[model samples]
Target: MVRNPLRAFFMMLGIAIGIASLTAMSTIGESTRQETMRQFKNMVGNYDLINIEPGASATRGMPSLTTVEPTLKFGDSDAIVEQVSGVKQVADVQNAFDLNVKYRDRTTAAAVYGITANWLEMHSYFIDFGSVLTDEDVASVARVAVIGPDIQNDLFEREDPIGKQIRIGGVPFLVKGVLVTRGAGPGGSSLDGIVFIPVTTASKRLFNRDYLTTITVELIEPLNPEPVLQEITAVLRERHGIIPPGEDDFGFVNPRAAAEQVAEVDSALTRILTGISVIATIIGGTVIMSLMLIAVSERRREIGVRRAMGATREDIMHQFLIEAAAASLVGGVVGTLLGVGGGVIAVLQQSMPPLIVWKSIGLAVVLSIIVGLIFGLQPAWKAANTDPIEALRS
Candidate 1:
């Protein structure tokens, strides 16, 4: 390193870049994965839950067009809850978006959902105060509303919301329930800026559409979702008059399964990137090996003097190998620090939570060192085999 700083710097630069790319890719992938998983759990999703929406496309990440006629309905939720085996609970949800909500002189735009009486159980949510929707409320299409905690802060302003009259979409609704505080749901949005009403009331008063936007199903204990999936598919197909060869116009969104699949794909991509990094490391090693070979050729006199002082062939090989490994090792450390630091900053600047992965760091350093050893061997061998007398003559 003292005699050939420039060559060592070039060699280290290559290895450092390789390590940095590898680490940065892994870190970014994992940070996104973690955020996705957190959002999945925060929303109306869990391993036992299944979401039924209108779509038949097999593609991922592409938005599917909704049919002119809706497919999933409130009756589907009833059938799933009553007839389907291995089913625990079911909720039918119909959404009215960006509607005006009013209480006394205060008015704000909020989303209103017409959900079943079992909406709380479906979302694992509890009532902070007041009462949840009842079967009677659904049957009679009662104008009762359950406000999330944020609505409480906004409209109620610490006053008791229960028994208060609020206008949702210009329809009068009594504040029957108040939901507990839920900070953030999927996509990093607060759950509080929403109102919940009975599906019948929503159908009669709000959207006036008989079809549901979503059907949420929660399965019984220890049951695999596959059987339930088949059962529900069969039911939906029969109801919708679809034959075996035809596909249903509804799609299933299983968050847990999707999250797992996402993780699998991310792992595969990371492996590919890691392989590319390894190749880069090997190229760096090749450069170092070539430089060492040139150094041996140019320092023939020095080698001869060392040989005269009783330095063995093995000693010469060890010295050259150590120098190559040291360069790569230093590169590895610098790259790890830079890569991790960059990832943290990028995630934070984007308003995402940062996650540090120690395994990637360790892997980068270890791979770099291994690359140095494997590629350094040939040069070390040639230097070791050099004849002292021939080198002195040259």
Candidate 2:
């Protein structure tokens, strides 16, 4: 019986497939979790600026002042920062609408932002070359531009881009800086494809619009965000002469809260995927059990001969159990190797992080052994109970 490599090979194959399936699922799930964390970190770092929108209840009291607009202005940002306590810095940004930027003969749809000097500090932006916009540049309305890495590579190539002029909406602005590669954000939006310019320059040269698209604010140290949010909301309400809270037109977001929400979503996804993988493992265990029972029936004569030759019931049980365990062990090893390889491939191709979880591997190995013991018990017991005289006669 021990010399039958062919039988053992087929048994091991089934267990191996089951283990591999489970391992692959776990690896992918872990990779997803890592990717989610990376994206959440990029979206909102340690803190967030709040955007306040009017609630529905406020609309009933004052129809004129309670009507909420869809947008907020740069002027509103300034008022909130100045009047609200616990507010440190304000970076008011305005977006250009459908602006066609031309670089000689090359042109593309570009997202242009008009940002304050503190935008670099607030966002922790590092320039690859030249310099970011200065306070003087903003005050003087300097027509300078900071291009993203994609724009630099596409339009500039190896040529020196600093001091080169690019036309946006037919207005020529000199290239002042090139931004370092920041890759893509969690929203799958390109972070390295836009252009940044001083808010004052954008206001004077382009849209001439007084309204701001968004404002990101930094809070003072040791201040709880909830109270700070309330203070900012009150200031904005007072400044806008908002008689009704429901009609307020602004919106606020806390980056910390957003990160927490993302974490919760990722946790739920991990649990769901993990549960499915576990079910696959269980199915594999069932297959192993069924196969073992068939093998016991076929090998009854061999078991009877062994018993007739002085093998005890305990010996027969141990032998059969060992064969089942050997199959599971082989499967566990092969599955772990395949899982690790698949994880590496996923990380390389999908921009997801490598998740090498030792605990998951350990759990998989332990589960495989447990599955062997549990599934093999009935077959091993049947082999042990074989009557030497009856099995021999059959």
Candidate 3:
């Protein structure tokens, strides 16, 4: 039979497009999964921190009256830490209400955290300059502050901010240190856009409130967080003089639990994308089969001439099958190259590093061969069974 290079080239193009699309989709899906996991790890931190808030319980199984009231005081943090076991450290944080800060003349909206000296060790935070607030500052209610990277950049503008005084809520507080950048949280909270001051100073001078908004507790080891969490709950309940089996007005978060939830979401996303890739491959195979059938019908005279020239039925079938396979193989190779190039372009455009999984490339090549064999069978058989005498007359 005569070989048609043009027909084979077009057939290969179709297969190549399908494979390339699948490869691009898979690479993006996998990268998204990895980035999400990285974000989750950063958001939860390395320790368990319980958030205490006010709530009401149902009376007689009916909804009771609920009021927005404060439930925890600034002093309760130390009380709980002293009473509870397995707690390595506790830091009470109180955000200033309307912290209008000013540096020389410029001003920006910022969150002011009243934290203890142990805040650094409790939350895996490090100082980029100078030193953190110490117990001496907290005890003496000293007017010293530590600012985040964003705050430092906005306030000082390339100047060494340490030892300089910044006015917070009309009160002058000396800059003691600058915190290393912590990037952004999952909720878009800017970790490096806030300011830190002594808890005692903030409570007395800034907000004048005895209640703390949140308390962060760190454990000696992350592996045994459940026991530490339980102990914290028990101590808080006892401190508040709650009766047996009563619900406490607090919430606890475990990093391990958050990581597990993220894994479930990642798995679901993978399955959905994989299904879409499979559908695309099936459509490509159908197109190849249709094109092969048309080729067989158009080459009827060529088939007859080969048979008349002593070419066996098996030989005729083998020749056509090989042509179909060759078309698909060529298409698969081109598709793989295009897919890799597209993946690299996407990463560079998005400011991400490019990654190519060799296993995915191998899988695409194998699938292309299987698609050719399955779709080319009927067309090859039809050509092999053609009548030589009828073909010669035509």
**1-394 per-residue lDDT for model 2 (tens digits):** 3566676666666666666666666677777766766665554433444434333332111123344444566677778777888888888787765577778888766779898898876776789889889998889988989988888877878888899999888889999999887776786666677888889888778868776766777878523676776787677777667776346555566566665676777778767766776676667667667778888888778888999899999999998788787777777778778867876787668767777778888888888788777778888998899888888887
TM-score of each: 0.86, 0.84, 0.81
- RMSD after CA superposition, every candidate: 3.1, 4.8, 4.9
Q: What are the per-residue Cα lDDT tens digits for candidate 1 across 221-245? A: 5246777888988888878788977
lDDT per model, in order?
Answer: 0.80, 0.73, 0.75
What is the TM-score ranking, best to worst? 1, 2, 3
Q: Which candidate is the best by TM-score?
A: 1
Candidate whose lDDT is highest: 1
Q: Using lDDT as the measure, name the better of candidate 1 and candidate 2.
A: 1
Candidate 3 wrongly placed segments (more than 4 Å): 1-6, 40-69, 96-98, 184-190, 241-246, 259-267, 300-322, 380-394
Residues forming the 10-long window of minimal summed lDDT in candidate 2: 56-65
Candidate 3 yields a Cα-based lDDT of 0.75
